[model samples]
Target: MHSAIPHLIELQRVDHLIVAVRTEIETFPKRVREADAKLSGARTAVAAARERLVNSQKDRKKFELDVQQWKDRAKKYRDQSGAVKTNEAYKALQHEIANAEAEVAKAEDAQLEVMMASEEAERRVRHAEANLKEDETAVTKERKVIETLQAEKKQQLDSLLAERERALAPIPEDLRELYTRIAKRHHGAGLAEARDGQCRGCGMRVLPHTLQELRRDPNEEIYRCESCGLILYTLEPVPVPGSASGSERAASSAVNHS
Candidate 1:
């Protein structure tokens, strides 16, 4: 593996983390809006229910005033009852009072209906208000949780961005430009692991000689995949030592003596 490959890999790691954190942070606004939408809907329901309640109250008041006016008219007709001398006039006066009393009965019935409707409207308003309060509590809690998560993601993104600069500092300018170009072409993935005789990025076969060279410990060659043009790195196997360490030799000597 080339000496620069490790630094490039580190830089790529930081970049990937930065992008992931940014993507997560971006969703916070939409989440807040969704929560707020529920709250807004609850508030609208409460407003509509209150409006209905107010209309019912107005209707009840109108019926009450109508009943009062009819009662007053009936009283006026009764006062004129004793003053009338003719039999037909007295009968007509009594008839007017009866009509006014009937109107009062009708108005009282309508007022009773209006009062019932007003009670139903009050029930609806209470129900809507309860829902609004419940929704507000839930939305407030949800927004707080979202805000906390967003803050954490922002911190992570800030740390990763600073680390990216550190990782990029040691890499040469030309190599950095090459990496940037390739990463842009490949959607922010410029490095690919070469393993199992294949390029992991594009699944293209790696040549045996190039594989052997990458496996070599002291290799300084920077390899790129022919098909996808992505820089490749390989995991070198750990070499087993043929000789024993001092601790092992001491144990072996002890066994021999025993």
Candidate 2:
């Protein structure tokens, strides 16, 4: 690894977290809206049910009035039957009474139908009102959960931004420019770990000279992957278990697995 690679790696780490936090925060509003929509839908259903109930009540009242009118007409015809002097006039009065009675029966039937409709409307209003309370409670809980996650992600984003600034502070301007350009193309991964002669970022084979240069302790020469153009780095070897020199490892185990 070059002298400046560590700082860039740190910056990349912060940038990745920042991107993740911002992406997660972006979803919070939609989730909140979904929760609000459920509540709004419940409220609309209740309103519609109440409106139906009200209209059904009005219709029942109108049918009741119609039934009363037909009853009154039948009563008037019966009263007039006594004043009829001729057989034809009395028969006409009887016919009128029969017609009025038939109308009364029809009106009563219509009124009964309206009353049944009103009962159904009342039942729907009750059912809707019951669901409305549950929707309200569920929306409140969902909103609270979304809002809490939103706040937490915002805090994480803020902290990452500050840490990014600190990580950027130690890096040189040229390195920062290079890292930014490269990271933009690679989703915040500006550097690749060089291990087993391969670029970990892109799975491309690393050149022998570049790998050799990177394996040097306190390396100063900056090298990039020929295939992917990402700045390359190599991890120091870990000591084998119970080795005499804790600083070195066996040939087969000379690797930074982490």
lDDT of 2 by residue, 56-77 (tens): 8998899889889988988998
Pairs that collide in candidate 2 are none
Model 2, C-alpha of 201: deviation from truth (Å) = 1.1
Model 1 Cα lDDT, one tens digit per residue, 80-127: 998999999999999999999999999999999999999999999999
**Which candidate ranks first by lDDT, i.e. highest?**
1
Q: Which candidate is the best by TM-score?
A: 1
Q: Give every collision pair in model 1.
A: none
Model 1: residue 220 alpha-carbon error in angstroms:
4.3
RMSD in angstroms, candidate 1?
Answer: 5.1
- Candidate 1 overall Cα lDDT vs. reference? 0.91
Where model 2 places Cα greater than 4 Å from the true spot, the runs are 238-258
Q: Please give the CA lDDT of all the candidate structures.
A: 0.91, 0.87
Error of 1 at 252 (Å): 24
